[model samples]
Target: MTKKDDHKDPALVSIGSMFETGKIRKMYTLAELYPTRIAKSLGINYGRYMVKLNHPDKFTMGEIVRLADLLDIEPDMITKVIYAELN
Candidate 1:
């Protein structure tokens, strides 16, 4: 999504909640899950990752895919992360 739509997306808000809770995994910090090389390549450097973590709509699906791979988490989990908190 574009910067204009970043905070307007509800799904992004939910994902942000997941990130904050560390419910995505033990390593919620993107830096901890992947090194500088991968994070940078994925366009999710430390600073950007923090921004996306706080505002998930700022993340592209490609970036999420990259992070999932880095964390060894199923890509589907990224979309459904909020369910874990709901249930």
Candidate 2:
């Protein structure tokens, strides 16, 4: 099976497809428009934060909200990406 078929998570596949299609590029750009400078202001470690939220680390909704705020994007966008990957 191809990698897409191997992926059990449709949301993740969807997000991946979105990226492959360049749909997420703007969002990614927007998210990173501000560097770690903002994260530092919030006492957040950018890489560690992503690892915590995206992988082994569990992130609270509040933390997600804080991240969204720091990234200057709606929390829903992040949630949508996650939910898309999960469901």
Candidate 3:
């Protein structure tokens, strides 16, 4: 049987690798998981959601918690990424 990845387009895999550095970016996570749906769940428009993602420090405590729940990740994971990016 062919490996699942064997069917993947080489060009697409190469481009995907370019974005898969060890560090995970918040925008990438949100974008990959459907930003529009997330924005609606957060009661905000896509533009505002994008702005908040671009400026991590602008996120409120409730938003942080809600995002963690939505993303199925620990709250600290999100905070750490934001802190690391800022520092």
Give the winner by TM-score: 3
Q: After aligning candidate 2 to the native by TM-score, how far in Å is the CA of 68 from where it should be? A: 1.5
Once fitted onto the true fold, the runs of candidate 2 whose alpha carbons sit more than 4 angstroms away are: 1-22, 25-35
In model 2, the worst 10-residue window by lDDT is 1-10
Q: How close is candidate 2 to the true structure, as a TM-score?
A: 0.44
TM-scores for every candidate against the unseen true structure: 0.47, 0.44, 0.65
Give the C-alpha miss distance for residue 81 in model 3, angstroms.
Answer: 0.7
How high is the lDDT of residue 18 in model 2? Answer: 49
Clashing pairs in 2: 11-84, 11-85, 12-85
Which segments of candidate 3 are over 4 A away from where they belong? 1-23, 26-29
Model 2 agreement with the true structure over 1-87: per-residue lDDT tens digits: 123234234433444344444465233332443435544544767775545544412556876665555444455665665555555
Candidate 1's C-alpha runs over 4 A off are: 1-22, 25-38, 82-87
**RMSD for each model, in Å, please?**
12.0, 13.2, 8.4
> In model 2, what lDDT does residue 76 have?
67
The whole-model lDDT of each prediction reads: 0.51, 0.49, 0.62
Q: In candidate 1, what are the lDDT values of residues 1-87, reduced to their tens digit?
A: 123333333533444456545556423343344346555756646677665655555667787676555444455666555344334
Counted clashes in each candidate structure: 0, 3, 0
